[model samples]
Target: MIKHIVFWRLNDTAYGNNKQTNADILKEKILAMQPKIDGLIKIEAGFDFSGEKDSCDVVLYSEFTNKDALHRYQIHPDHLEIKKWLAEVR
Candidate 1:
């Protein structure tokens, strides 16, 4: 199995949305991809609540059958859209 992880620290105001708001949207969009992407064993995304100064605002954890599966997920349309939004927010 392959594990794919991503972390994002969003600006206080980005893409016309606050950090928490963008985190919520990101969680919704990322979690909704499980059914659409093949070889996706599991996936989860959420805002961090550690209250640590160095913690990221949002994190994505995913498991795939293999590298090829991970590659497929990377290029999937839904994921591509999310990537674009993330870039804008960054």
Candidate 2:
């Protein structure tokens, strides 16, 4: 299995919502991928509860069957769409 993890320190406000709300939105989007993509064995997103100034706002953890699966997920159109929105918010 291959694991991919990502952390994001979102803007204080984006998409007309606060950081925590945006985290919720991101988590929903990321988790929604489980049934939509192939070779994605497992996936989850997390919120930062540390309440520390330096902590990230959200996190994504994913598992793939192998390198090919990971690569496909990286280039998949659905993920690309999310990546675009993510760039703007982050």
Model 2 C-alpha lDDT per residue in residues 1-90, reported as the tens digit of each score: 999999898998888998888888888889888987789999999998989999988889999999989998999888998899898789
* Candidate 2's TM-score: 0.95
Please list the C-alpha lDDT of all candidates, in the order they appear. Answer: 0.91, 0.90
Best candidate, lDDT: 1
Give lDDT for model 2.
0.90
What's the TM-score of every candidate structure? 0.93, 0.95
N/CA/C clash count, model 1: 0
**Each model's backbone clash number:** 0, 0
**Per-residue lDDT of candidate 1, residues 7-81 (tens digit):** 999888887888889889999999999999889999999788997999998989999999999999999999999
CA deviation > 4 Å runs, candidate 1: none
Candidate 2: segments with Cα more than 4 A from true spot: none
